[model samples]
Target: MTANVQNLNAERYSNEVFELWANQQNLNKSEDYLLKKYITDTSKHVLEAGTGGGRLSFYIEEKGFNNISAFDVVPNMIAHAKKRASTNDSNINFSISDAAVLENYESNSFDYLVYLQQVLCFIDKKDLFTNALKEAYRVAKKDAIVMFSFLDYESKIYNPALSSFVNVLRKLRSEEQSSRHLPWLKINNDINWKLFHKNQPKTYWVKRAEITSLLEDIGFSIEEVKNANQFSKNTGKRKGILYVVCKK
Candidate 1:
């Protein structure tokens, strides 16, 4: 299940359309606020996980951050980011690496870590999610600050649609569905308002308490938990998505 989820996510993000879309995006309000508020030292070594198209990394570089290392599991996304870096003449280190396993990064190396864009919730199972969190803890320096985002299970937007039906069928056959697994089963027309639908990867929606418990268990001190919209004072929008800051 883990391999399948990983492969599907890689393929989904590797799509040319999605890559272009990701590349064009800038730091959202929550991300911008967190970076401004928490990351005071730009010269310190920073690591970013699931850095799709180098969006956040590019933003950080523009803010005078010199020692930044960013990685994404999808090869094409990393390739696109490298191309962007070359075009911009930036020195941000971009690589292909999985969040669940940071085999290439040294322990206690990064002074800060970035895991935004709801990247953690993409892992299929709880154990793998824990492993990913454990990796985050291992790679961070003492007192290193880490910021991550997750899809909120309490948000009605994440309530199972295709997953609900799929899980019912699986249960009838005595087959287990991966926990909190919700697939992108609806049409998204955000690209120039043109409707398109595709069978894509699943993302796990997590309860607020559940993620906090896991982070604390993995030895991170929780700093703050806020709805993504709170940063913009737009409390009514995107209510179920959350961003959290912690210290190692």
Candidate 2:
């Protein structure tokens, strides 16, 4: 089952496609802010789950984090990450591992754990997310920081233009094999063809209350939930992202 999921992800987002998608998204400002907030005044071990292409991990390394490890479920993604590390001469340990299962990492082994963007949504299992949280908590010292971001559903409904743009992009990616807007090569398999045709890849939306409640249920207290509008002074329509910082 895990292998199937990995293969799907690999086929959907190959190295070229992943690079193109990463380049298209102007996420550096937000990612930099979040990384600074999480990696401040601490010299403890850090782990980035779902570290596709080692993009965020590399950014964190550039910001002076010495002890950092990264993992992705897809082997091809991990391979791309390794190539990235070598190209940049970074010493990050890139591995292929499931975020939901962290039994190999010993208890109290890390001081920080981060999941950028929509890493949690890809799990497809609430129990798996809960278990991942539990494992993160177990492997962190008291007061360790865990930070992540998600789509704010409330804000999303207010931006029809952006919503329509996303829909059009999805449609283009699904229908046009030669669309350079997407990074992955054209998939020819029937299952993949049906999957892509039926499911448009849009952002996953979660309510603030639901996120806070989940953190609390998982034995972490939320330190802050920074709406994107607060930092940018943009209207609610522009603040489609939410960043949550919690302490374990």
Best by lDDT: 1
What C-alpha RMSD separates each model from the true structure? 3.5, 7.5
For model 2, residues 1-248, the per-residue Cα lDDT tens digits are 14333344545556425665333324556676777766875367888877877777887787788888888776777888898789889988888777678755778777888877656555534556556667767877788888877766666554455445545766766643212112211333223333234333322356788878988888899987777766666554446478888898
| lDDT of the structure predicted as candidate 1 | 0.79
Strongest candidate by TM-score: 1
Clashes of each: 0, 1
**What is the TM-score of each predicted model, taking all chains together?**
0.88, 0.74
What lDDT does the true structure give each of the candidates? Answer: 0.79, 0.65
Output the lDDT of residue 74, model 1: 81
Pairs that collide in candidate 2 are 17-183
